[model samples]
Target: MSERKVLTKYYPPDFDPSAIGRTPKHLRKQGPKVITVRLMAPFPMKCTNCGEYIYRGRKFNARKQTLEEKYLNIPIYRFFIRCTRCSGEITFRTDPKNMDYECEKGAKRNFEPWRDSKSGKYNETEEETLDRLEREENAEHEQQERDKMAELEEKMHDSKREMAIADALDEIRTRNARIARNEGKDDEAALDSIHEQVDESLLQAEREDEEAARKAFMTANGERIKRIVEEEEEDPVPTAAPVSAQSKPAASISMPPPSSTSFSRVKKTKKSGNLLGIKKKPSLV
Candidate 1:
């Protein structure tokens, strides 16, 4: 171990360094540059050489090489792997256009339902596929144009409806203002009429009170005059003493008492006449 680790080594005194010969350039190996790599299977496939199945994600020691073909300037690479069961060679290459791998020889890839569905291919001719694509694009453009026109028409209709609603609101507000003003005038007139009626009623009440007072005064005055006349009729009148003997003898000659007829006549006269000197018709006996 110590001799192997040493940087310097012993040499024979008789050795000659110039006797060795070099190979010619034409005799050197020539081929495409290939490199060994570790990778997993990209997809499930079956080997044609040995009828062996290879599943995706299986690790392998593969030989990778750059290919002559390219897609849109992107380089494509080919890989060679051997089957695990029979050690048969399998070749596949990168497909940049589809972003997937393609089997070239020695193996066949399994069918993929998802890939077929996405490509929408049914083994149709090239011309038919092109026509279908063009028709689809035209239909899409027409649909977009129709949508834009419909949106524009809807906006115009909304603007017109809004304008009409605003006009109606303005008319309604103006009418309401006019009605309010008229109602105010009517209220003022009603107040004036009510005041006039109250004043008339007050005047009528005053007139009635005055007439009632006058009638009461007349009734009281007439009652007082009637009482005075009744008192005078109830009292008897006294005669004066005879001044001379002849008058004494005349008074002594018992004058026949005044007749009841004469007293009745005075009473009737007093009752028939008033202080105002108006005569009343005699009452029936």
Candidate 2:
């Protein structure tokens, strides 16, 4: 047989075990009430599945079960209600400590994937999602605007380069035109100078020819005058003959008449200053 164990405590020696059934008057004095929890049977008022309003005093033979989860220490009560109208079965659960009820099918006692621990609700709403999409769209639009600005700058650069090239071409063309004009002017001036030279040469040649012809005429006239003077110097000189006395000199002669009239010729003579027969007298003499 198994032996029974006895417990002893320090108290009055006259204490009896039967006296414990009666409470003391001073201990029975009322004090502040305390809150306690109780798990009671479900009310028989309404079956959410059956849609039948069962009377409060009536008894319902409903099935009850205890559901437990790893995160919760308290047991949950599950009630299965059967509908008399459509024979539909509905289950309901209750948290005995909290006195909270939930539909068995719709009860979300497990870990919710959509809820956030901080906000205590599901994910972002439709408005928030739309706002995010709009923000992304605006960012893309800004990027496009930046690209357009860059493209415009490139086009402007090209335009400036092209404008500069066009200006340079115009300057070159203008310079060339000016040079051509100057060359044309120079050519005209050169032609005029050549004409002036040609005219001067022709005039000089005409003057020279006239001078030569005048000099030749003078030389021929000088030769003819020299020939005439030389012929005159070579001719012989003539003298007068003396008159005879026989014919007419009887009266002119001083002497008597010659015997038997036979006349004797008398001679006359003249003297020159030079012996070489060249003239020595001056032109004035």
Candidate 3:
């Protein structure tokens, strides 16, 4: 067999390449060989092997593959990618439960804590629910701290009240003790003054009685002596006067001799007169 060669190359001025016929819209067009779907990646990713960073919102030409897993009657899909630097295989899958693409292996995404947003109510996702749960936990913790602080404050207030009451009681006790001491001193002073007055009155009464007795004794002695002398001069050698038996027995007399002389006994049958009164003395003249 010989290789045949032919050549005729020319372009007409009226040729329009866009005039070619295309398939009708109603007919089913052939599907593309490279199936692509937009993915939402809200965080940066780093390759596990090469530590290469893939920034957020980056576009990647990933090859799609079917997964055996199914959720809620929807078939799961997987995508395989390669690291730009190391060309290491990276893979991710669609998560129907969380409604986001999850890295199956070979890469790590920056951790992002969940939070609620303005559109969370309309287009709520699993992240929104997680955010609500986190908020509830935080609120519970704050409430607990507030309760502990309130309890501590109450204890402090009670302690302050107790201290105040103790101080008051101590002050009252001291005041009562001082008052009792003053009263005791006053009683002692009063007792001493009363005792002194009583002693002085008793001494004064005793002195008055002694003076009256002395005066009475002196008066009686002078009168008795003068009367005895006159009676002796007038009744010298006079006979003794008679007296009642009861009165004579109750009386006796003793006197000093004025001058020495002889004396005679009276008759035994006659009763003696009161000797200290005006009795006659028998004299030897």
Full-model lDDT for every candidate: 0.84, 0.62, 0.76
TM-score, cand. 1 vs. native: 0.47
Prediction RMSDs, each to the true structure: 30.9, 42.7, 30.1
lDDT of 3 by residue, 40-118 (tens): 4445789999899988877777787776679878988888777889999888888777677778888997665552345
Model 3: weakest 10-residue lDDT segment is 223-232
| Candidate 3 lDDT score relative to the true structure | 0.76
Q: Which residue pairs collide in model 1, if any?
A: none
- What is the C-alpha lDDT profile of model 2 across 1-285, one tens digit per residue? 233454654678888876687877786976433332233334434444545654423343566665554214666656765554555665667744334455564212333344335662234556776787799999999999999999999999999999999999999999999778667777778678779999999999999999887677666546422333444556666676666777665667787566753666657765665665768766884
What would the per-residue lDDT of candidate 1 be over residues 1-285, giving only the tens digit for each residue? 688999987878987656658756697787767999999999999999888889999999999998777777999999999999888889999976557888999999898887685565654556877898899999999999999999999999999999999999999999999778667787778678778889999999999999887676666546422333444456666787657756565546666788768656443344535777897888999
Off by over 4 Å in 3: 1-42, 115-285
Q: Could you arrange the candidates by lDDT from highest to lowest?
A: 1, 3, 2
- The best candidate by TM-score is 1
Q: What's model 2's overall lDDT?
A: 0.62
Error of model 1, residue 150, in angstroms: 2.8
Q: Which of 1 and 2 is ahead in TM-score?
A: 1
